[model samples]
Target: MTTKTIREIALAWKSDKQRYVKQSTYAAYVLILENHLLPSFGDYDSLSEKLVQEFVLQKLENGLSVKTVKDILIVLKMVMKFGVKNEWMNYCEWDIKYPTSETNKDLEVLTIAHHKKILDFIKENFTFRNLGIYISLTTGLRIGEICGLKWSDIDVCNETITVRRTIERIYMVEGDCKHTELVINTPKTKNSCREIPMNKELLAMVKPLKKVVNNEFYVLTNEEKPTEPRTYRNYYHRLMKRLEIPRLKYHGLRHSFATRCIESNCDYKTVSVLLGHANITTTLNLYVHPNMEQKKRCITKMLKSLRK
Candidate 1:
């Protein structure tokens, strides 16, 4: 049996893991291990429920979101399991819990008025960057996916935009994914590699440029090199300020799109597919909050059918 500390096993585990996962995923794991797990538990010979619980509470107190803390715990458990298999550390099935009564995390969304105003502005004063925001609202594209889009991915003849790649600035450390911080890679999952149809307005806006723009150029920049997410986010924030609309995170555009789909009574499965969600349940939980009117309508429909 080996007696290496958690830190030792983690180092070996990371190197081994790099071979199996995407560079972006591997980079994320490394960041978690180094920044959170290593500083807290690396020197320990064995991890315990109490100490891990304390770590969780500390992270929560330090303002990390419950989701972020849970993700960190997931990486911690992965390393522990890897160590157990190698006989470098002991194992425990830790049932970590988070306080449920913390706060209601409401999603940021554009009011219908603000949404229409932004779209109208983009149409009147056209820019490539502004087009990205319009696409997200209409198509539910994640920021990175839109940033990575190329002219060739948009098909004027077919009237579709194919999500092929996503661009992000990945956190990196020694031993892996060291080429560049800014990366362009395949979409988040197999489901993310999807094709979404453009609505008439979006199609009309882009069809004219199809022949004139270089096919290899990124849609956002209309240039060979693409703008990264951080830069794009700044641009979006400036536009929001100019228009005097309440500022929302860039992802709120996708959220707004899905919300509109749900409001239109579009099928959940169709909305999920269009959003490139790996599962339909994700689409439901995020977008399917029924109000009193919707609930009333549902009851009325059910009772009417029963009477018939």
Candidate 2:
């Protein structure tokens, strides 16, 4: 077999694995490889562990945040493994480890008051937007999961919704996804494909929304097609601006839901399952686990028990 360049090997791996993964994930892997990995180590057929570490340090020096550089390094490691499997390069130690960032200590989640304000604003200004936001805020569903939702996925009779697909905004060179113009893809992982119970309020909201759809997707386009993430983002942004509320990314809604769940004394494992997180550790790491207030309350309750 003829030896191939790092770029060629990376592209081959991507092409071979494209069918096995969701388009959104493939796009992310392609982006990291194209923009970060190949540019730095394209000349080398195989990289040394020490060399890879040095490259990571240089990226950090070049003003790349540790988080971004960490993601880039992960992509490099994947490509290197691909090269090794293809016999383009010998086995090399995977040395680059993601740096621990303190920023992940606690998520900046929306407060209950803020949640109420946002909900009120949506109800007053855009009643149609209410169902989607309500479901996300209540169930902690990812934006893509909510957007990819179909009527068939929702079981009003059972009060559960099956999360099978996810609608994400992927940058495709050509326009294929008509609803969003961004590539819509499946859920990222098997765990992401979960079944969550529907709250009574969410059920009520969806019932009317489904009536409008005439038994199509719970969320759809004007002609009853699936609603796109881009359109929802635009509407969400407009709603935020009009309401004069703090402009947080639409993703903040999911964070808000997680925060509210924790505050309501919901356990981490349950929240993790609700969020479709791969594990409880991910839920604890990404969402606020136990804030100072919660800690104090726990201590106080324990002391009361001791006194008793």
Candidate 3:
């Protein structure tokens, strides 16, 4: 067996791993490795759980979010596991911990009035770009998915839309320079490739436009070349500003859709599928908080059961 440094193992692992993952995913892994792992542990002779724990703590102290740190650790573990499998290093179990005082903050969602206001304004003055926002508000499509949507993906007769692909700009580092490229690829998970039923309102808006547009054209641009997410995001921001609505991240549209579904008593599993979540727990965790009325009803039911 031959001993190798972490950097050597990482380079080998990356070369082997690239063939199995999507380009966007491979790019992300490379970015994390170059920015976080290589700088800290590349030259280290050996890896241990204690060393990894300290790395995690240092990353957190430098103002990285817990989730971001965890992502970096995941890449680290993958490379470490690769090294062990190839007999280049020893393996050890790792159980990392974080500060308990740090809690995941509640997700931000639009209020009913704000949601309706945006919808109403779009209805009154509709544009192709505005239609993307409408689709997100109604169907909970992510920015990438919506931007990637094509006219062919919509089934007017069946009133369904297929989420087949997504587009995003990925950052690439070459030596000392950094650049970005827009990539269109299949969604990261199978669950993200889903079909959502279009409401009558959405169908009506899309029907007339679909007749004249090229099937290959993107819904947001109505051309072969689709608008990138960053550009669409800027459009969304300007619309919100002009309407005097409070600024919310583009992802808030998805949260608002899920929240409205839960508010209307939509089943948890069904909402999970509609949102194209990998599992139901994601739906529950992000959107299932009970209000005062729900809590009160639960208590009342408990008291009634006691009487029995």
Clashing pairs in model 2, backbone N/Cα/C closer than 3 A: none
Query: Which consecutive 10 residues in model 3 have the weakest lDDT in total?
Result: 171-180
TM-scores, all models, native as reference? 0.96, 0.84, 0.96
- What RMSD does each model have against the real structure? 1.8, 3.7, 1.4
lDDT of 1 at 102: 84
Q: Residue-pair clashes per candidate, as listed?
A: 0, 0, 0
Off by over 4 Å in 1: 175-180
Clashing pairs in 1: none
Q: Tens-digit lDDT track for model 2 on 160-273?
A: 888888887775422233221365566877788888998776676566655555555445442356677778888777867776777878888988888888778788898898
For model 3, what is the error of residue 210's alpha carbon versus the real structure, in angstroms, after optimal superposition? 1.8
Pairs of colliding residues, candidate 3: none
Q: How far is candidate 1 from the true structure (C-alpha RMSD, Å)?
A: 1.8
Summarize candidate 1's per-residue lDDT along 237-282 as a digit string, tens digits: 9999999998899999999999889889999999999999999998
lDDT (CA) for every model shown? Answer: 0.93, 0.74, 0.93
Q: What alpha-carbon RMSD in Å does predicted model 2 have with respect to the real structure? A: 3.7
Off by over 4 Å in 3: 174-177, 303-308
lDDT of 3: 0.93
